[model samples]
Target: MSYPSLAPYIQKRPWLMRWMRPLSEWYFDNAGYRKLGLRADDLIPEEDEMVQLALKRLSPKEAYDRVFRMRRAFQDYPYLSPLVKEVMAEQTEREDLESMVINKRKAAGEKKAH
Candidate 1:
């Protein structure tokens, strides 16, 4: 990709530029770039509050349609590849670490009871 061609994508997502530059060069030199993952991942909602409000007022399909169209409009926006579920799992692990600390404190208290 020419510097000019890649400018917009880089501006939109600065983090990717570090990886994208090399990826693009290899893709162009070896073969034409293939478009993959067009529908592989789930798209996120633009506004959770707005979506919930509309869901109450409209039919389920209609509510979903509104959300889908908004996401489709900004599909060009950069997003992390991993799902939010994975991020939530990491968060739960952090909570478990805190719980372990609390449990250890309780165990110490119980030992002192005697």
Candidate 2:
């Protein structure tokens, strides 16, 4: 559900932000999650391990509020995105390091054989 965000670019230009603000508000309003009492973060999927970890990290009050909102919205429990991205980045780095080590070992073995 990741989409390109023009927010940073728009923020750098006051004129562009002023022009887009109304349209952005209109789009969000029309999106209708607010009508259901759900904030944008509530829509993030909970199936991922990173999202689950993020949920566990929530403060007691925030966790309660999240549950309340979901129940009120007639839905089930669910930065979620930022946490997920962080977890993914960590996983990628770990894998890259492991591959590098494996390659180094292989190259060392080849040198020995030669």
Candidate 3:
């Protein structure tokens, strides 16, 4: 079967999907390491689970608040570890938007005034 076919199968079989998390993790850990990879490290769990884990270890509201706070701070965390410096370099580089829009508009205004 192809990947597209598996989507509906997994959706229709929630129990099967739940059971396959470990297998999926294993597949991601090896061949798919960069993306579907980092199985153990990428386990963000879910909102409710984070809340429950937080409540169990801390307080109910505290856990909820902490989860959201962490999410806002580190949601891009998965890519940051490897891509932080690279992303910073890109952000500082020449702006495509500036070249296309600002320069074009300036030329157009000059032509109109002439």
TM-score winner among the candidates?
A: 2
- Candidate 3 residue lDDT tens string, 1-114: 112447578868989989887887787666543442233323445456554564577657765665566565454446555698887767666565456654444664465655
Model 1's TM-score against the true structure? 0.24
Residue 24 lDDT in model 3? 79
Candidate 1 C-alpha error for residue 60, in Å: 32
Q: lDDT of model 2 at residue 90?
A: 100
- Residue-level error in angstroms, candidate 2, position 28: 1.7
RMSD in Å for all candidates: 13.3, 13.5, 11.2
Residue 102 in candidate 3, Cα distance off native in Å: 13
Candidate numbers, best lDDT first, in rank order? 2, 3, 1
Structure candidate 2, residue pairs in collision: none
Residue range 26-95, candidate 1, lDDT tens digits: 8655642123222211233425776456457877786676557556645745555466778998999998
Candidate 2 lDDT at 91 equals: 100
Clashing pairs in 3: none
Q: Give the TM-score of each candidate.
A: 0.24, 0.52, 0.27
Task: Provide the overall lDDT of each model, using Cα atoms, as 2-decimal numbers.
Answer: 0.58, 0.83, 0.58
